[model samples]
Target: MKTAYVKVPFQFKFEDVPVPKCGSNEALIKVMACGVCGSDMNAARVEAQDWQSFGHEITGVVMETGENVSNVKVGDSVLVESGSYCGTCAQCRNGRPDLCASGTGLFQWKICGFSEYMTLDKQCLIPFDPEKIGYAQGTVIEPMGVALDLFYTTDIKFQDDVAVVGLGPIGLMALRLAKAAGARNVYGVVRNRKNTARIKLAKEFGATDIIYTDETPLEAYPFPAGGVDKIMVTAPPSVIASTFRAANLGAVIAYIGIDYGDRGTISFDANYFHYKKLQLRASYAVPALYFPRCMELIADGVIDVDKLVTSTFPLEDLEKAMCTLRDDKEKEIKMVMVRPELL
Candidate 1:
């Protein structure tokens, strides 16, 4: 089997590797498409040591199932949740599987994805209709699930004004979800480079206004103080305080940025937060708990998955794809790589 590895920082190489085997209770999944996650770019730029195994946003077909597997079968078009939850955990017992411990996997053992083929427990497999979303687009459910989790972290009441700082895929999807959930006015914030162009698409998704933080000062965001009812900071830690600066009186701010390196902190006006009754919360990937609704949004045509994708490459272009994502911030937003044999 041919597999891709990060030869070093800023590089990826494909080489022949043995195919992974399945356990008695697991199933083998042939990769169809694996979307390049934003975190991949993080590991690429920061030189994270354990980034060789990429592709958490994966969608594949079941090639074989173990004797004990009953929920999934061969020929099923599926996505793996990767055993994100431990049912015994306090969060899990309270029905918050997304907050599950990281040690457990789908089959109650360790699971490693992002190869030509891999094994997972049937419990981790989620079957989806290819006709509705197709193989490549279905891979988006992984990031979408995380975006959905952010929604759960905050109360985005129907018709409330909302803002999403950093108009990346997650922010873009959150914009769309806010609209679908009936946000009266959706605001998008982005840097003033070529990234500001993303605001045009954000408007298409649901944003009513675009705050060019690069051109406009953060303290001057939304103008005259009292701004959006709710804000989600999808960018970095530095953007957290900016959200508060642009926040309205009694607003809720949800953030989801993990700075693996560097100081991930920012300074903001404490008086503003106190006087405005501002709220803040940090959000992270929650064990793929929202896969079903994520798929349903794509399948039901509620989410524009096609528009979200910027590029698609074959296995041979793995290096180019990673480099493009790392360097090409202006044009590329989301990309997926399809390994034909893995399908």
Candidate 2:
């Protein structure tokens, strides 16, 4: 089996290794497709480390299951959860599995999904009806779960005016979900750029307005009822403060992002927040909830995964795919690489 790895400032390569073995409680998955995430590009640029495996957004087939595995069987098509909750955890017992403290996997397997075959704990596999979804669409379930988490976290109300700062795939999904949930005005915020691809899709997916930060600051955007009732930020931590300025009185702000060093810290107006009775919530889609719901949304024609998945590459084209995603963000929304033979 061949697996992808990256190290140093920007080095990436593939190495042949023995196919991973399924543990007593694990399942061996024949990876069919994996989506390249923005964080993967960021890791290649900023992280310095020894050669390590990366890609996580995954959809695969169950080739084998350990003796203890029963949730799924061989030949079952599945989407791997990047995270899973321990059923024994206190939070799970309290019916709040999303907050499970002992939940495992920021990414399920040590070997990663960027390989021909990998083994993971059976708990991370969510079996889906392959007849209803294709491999490429399956690759998006994880990210859709993320968007759903942000939607629920913000508690967006019907007829509420909303602004989604950062028009990445996740941001686009967020805005679309907000619109489907009945938000009156869906705003997709982006930095000034000429690539109208994202801006145009935002409208197609239900964004009522596109706010280019350089042209008109989010704080100055004219939304109904004084300002947007809800704000969802999927950008870096730095954008949180200015994005919050667009929120209406008593509005809720939900954000999911990560940054290292000084860039991780953000400063916003505490007095203004207090006076406005604003609620700020952090959304981390751990335990990777809502896969089934996301799949339903995709299958029922609500999400239109084909529109968001702008490009596909075979596994052999990993380098080209990564470069396209890193250097040409304007064109590609979500890139998925597949093993055609495996598929």
The digit string of per-residue lDDT tens for model 1 on 102-217 reads 43452343324456787776667888888877778887788887788787676799868888888888888888888889988887878775764366679888778787776886
RMSD for each of the candidates: 2.7, 1.6
lDDT at 302, model 2: 82
Candidate 2, residues 192-298: lDDT per residue as tens digits? 87656788889899888788889988888777677889999999989988876787889898999888889999988799989989998999998789987998888
In model 1, the runs with Cα more than 4 Å from the true position are: 102-113, 222-225, 269-271, 341-343
Q: What's each prediction's TM-score? A: 0.91, 0.96
Clashes of 1: 4
**Each model's total of backbone clashes:** 4, 0
Tell me which residue pairs clash in candidate 2.
none
